[model samples]
Target: MGDIFAEGVGIAGRSRTALAAFALGMSLVSSAMSFAVDDTPGIGAEMAVSSVAGYFLFWQVMATEGLLDGSRSRGAGFMAYAAVSLITSVAGLLGLVLLILPGLILMARWSLAGALVVARGSAVFAALGESWRLTRGFTWPIVGFFAAVCMAFAVLLLPLGIYAAVSDETANIGAAHYIVEFISNVASYGLSALISCGIVAIFALLVDRDERMASVFA
Candidate 1:
């Protein structure tokens, strides 16, 4: 009925505006971790640990203030959502053999549901239930929106991908050739993080609108 995606965009914008620093910090941490992994094997493990810490820290900031509803209950809610995501990711990875689409759908839905859990101060199951309910009549629209976004992102990254391919072919580079590759990877990681944050914001807006509409009706 309502323009759920438009609502998600607005909420995401506000969330991003409020938590820009956190997002930037997380992106930098993730990028550095990726760079470290490419450069050194031993240090890569340490960087990976640091990246996880940074991720949770960023989630704390976004969940506490960006959601505007769960400042006190943020810790529990965040943990719950994180648990759900971990399970989802693991299942998706392991079960990709049986049915790819189910795994992929679970992955996508869990992400939005995790955000919903934080924003709504609900349990992970409840967040998922809400997501299902909100998406009931708008599945195709949501899918189309995601496809469009993905296509746009692929187009935007075409030049970078081309350059990477060209470099690999022309230089015949090995993994030991880390400098340029690391730099390029970091740049790509940052760009991807920014775009991902934008997309997540859009979904957050949709979740917020669904909550508001349900409240009004009730």
Candidate 2:
């Protein structure tokens, strides 16, 4: 059996390397969208949209950085990466429509494709293959990590959510609600960025461990 806790510990130890980059990227996207949505009724939603964009961007940067390891990528083949994601998403969606279990399994197995692309600079299909290979016997762990992330977020946000719900009809509701929402938003984004870093760290750790195991058995 794999030492799941050890994998988590290793990821936590390396989170600092990727956290700042993820946060900065997300912040920039959020701020830029904030300006665009100024005085808009749906500003919060707009900001959320931008933050999501930033999140994806941050992961790309993390993958690029992880693969190169402090070196610069002339170009990590962005078109290829995007194409890979689109293709996989479509297939995953179809699988989901056909069967929930298979779809989820496919999603988890292909989760590392982008990172593999960064690491190997290979074609999208090749990267997918690499991710699938590296994740063998580790799919459950990968799903568990995501579940852990979700649980962490849910635990943290439950109180705020309850407060918001309870206060919805009280006087000064707008002000208090905004306060709670602001805190909730910040907490959510911060947690999300942390999880993204953990993902990069895990990808790095997994590939490294697999390589070490291969060399040992060879």
Highest lDDT scorer: 2
Model 1 agreement with the true structure over 1-218: per-residue lDDT tens digits: 13545654554455454345444554455456655666476356644554454345446535533544645453546566666567655865665567755654554554466556555567877877766665565555554555454565566566656765777778955563445444444444444444345435545556656667889999
Model 2 C-alpha RMSD vs. true structure (Å) is 5.2
Runs in model 2 with CA error above 4 Å?
Answer: 1-21, 24-75, 79-104, 158-173, 212-218
Clashing residue pairs found in predicted model 2: none
Candidate 1 wrongly placed segments (more than 4 Å):
1-66, 70-76, 90-111, 156-206
Quote the positional error of residue 127 for candidate 1 in Å: 2.8
Q: List, residue by residue over 1-218, the lDDT tens digit for candidate 2.
A: 13544644555455544555554555555445644765474576655464445445544546544544345363645556666667766877897699755665786688777666555566888888988988888888776665666578789999997897788656547776766766676677667665555556567667766777989999
Minimum summed lDDT over a 10-residue window in model 2 is located at 63-72
| lDDT values, one for every candidate | 0.54, 0.63
